[model samples]
Target: MVALIATAFVQTGFAQHDHATHQTQSSALLPLYYNIKDALVVGNASLAAAKAGEFVEALKNADAKIVTGANRDGLLEHSGKIAGSKDLKSQREHFAGLSTDMIALAKGSKLSTEPVYQMYCPMKKTSWLSSEKTVKNPYYGSAMLTCGKVVETIK
Candidate 1:
């Protein structure tokens, strides 16, 4: 009878421990998801603007995403490109190829394992602003891709 009591106690303790671990991991991941979504929205706008040659509209798209708090799609990440306005019809035709590459990056294995931008190339003026890009996407200097992982969690 004593042995039975001890065994049950051990089982109870283990179950509680497992629950706590699961909760911890789930909680840790929530912030990552939110951060990734926000970055994608911002990055997408830049991509769109680069193609359209309208930097202002790209910024607007990014701002809109940040303000709307839309997280319906489960955090798209991967070095993806949202869409940019291509000024030339011939060059615009090249974007379809870009879509394939963007999709692959969006669904990359590191979407959760690592950061979309795990580098540290800060702006020349501010040491605290990572909200913008460091190196222009060479393809379009006006288009930026600076958002990164969630450094801090909300709750």
Candidate 2:
């Protein structure tokens, strides 16, 4: 009975460690996501595509337990679309979907140590995440720069 108890304790400890590790890995994806968003904000489709490709590689490297099901599928799908396209319009279109999934992921997980702002574009009717409170609308770039407002702050 004592041996069984020890085994159970060890198992519980390992489970907790796995969960903590998963959270850390999930948080690591934020920088990669931001890279793509920053590229879009600058109106650089090629850079955005390159960043999307890098984000995809980061996701692929993440532990399988970090993201699962629809979350994983959506991230891969949207980022892959952006990575494959060189056209700014096409990349931005895919970015909306990618941002949606990213927002969901950010909301569902403790993805950052600092507050993350969720900014909304009234014109595009879409939202994206940012490490800062100030909005640099990725949807419209400089055409309508500062077009969005901070809709939520994920702490």
Candidate 3:
């Protein structure tokens, strides 16, 4: 009985530690994600692709087991699409998908240490994530940099 109690205590401690680690890893991807977004906003497909690669690596390091189901697969698939394409238009297309999945993932995981803005462009009819309250259009770049509005803020 004493041994059983000790084992339970150890398991409980491990579970708490694992939860904290999971939170840290989940939140760690935001800055990388933002970097990718910024590159896209500047109409730099090559830079965006490079950042996407880094995002994918960070996702892998975050541990797939912690993010099971569609969220994990969607992130990997979309980020891969972004990384595999060099064309600015193609990158932005894939980025649309990536942002969709990321918004859901952020909501589900409760990631982002600060509020993440879900900004939407009326012309594109698509949304992207932002660390700030202001809109910086990733789809139109400087052609229409401030074309979007904050539709939602996830904290």
Q: Is candidate 1 or candidate 2 better by lDDT?
A: 2
* Per-residue lDDT value at 44 in model 2: 97
Superposition TM-score, candidate 1 onto the true structure: 0.29
Q: Please write out the lDDT profile of model 3 over residues 10-111, one tens digit for every residue.
A: 999999999899888888888888998999999999999999999899888886766667887888888888998899898888888889888888888778
Model 1 lDDT, residue 110, Cα: 21
TM-score of each: 0.29, 0.89, 0.91
Model 1 gets an lDDT of: 0.32
RMSD of 2: 1.9
Task: Report lDDT (CA) for all predictions.
Answer: 0.32, 0.91, 0.88
Badly placed stretches (over 4 Å) of model 2 are 1-13
Error of 3 at 143 (Å): 0.5
Candidate 2 lDDT, 1-155, residue by residue in tens: 99999999999999999888888789988998999999999999999999999999888887876677888899999999999999999999999999999999898888999999999999999999999988898888999989989999998
Q: Enumerate residue pairs that collide in model 1.
A: 47-83, 47-84, 48-83, 48-84, 51-84, 51-85, 51-86, 52-84, 52-85, 78-105
Residue by residue across 5-120, what tens digits does model 1's lDDT show? 99999999998997665444433332332332243334444444343333223223332222122221211211122233323322223333332332332333222333333222
Ranking by TM-score: 3, 2, 1
Name the 10 consecutive residues with the lowest summed lDDT in model 2.
Answer: 60-69
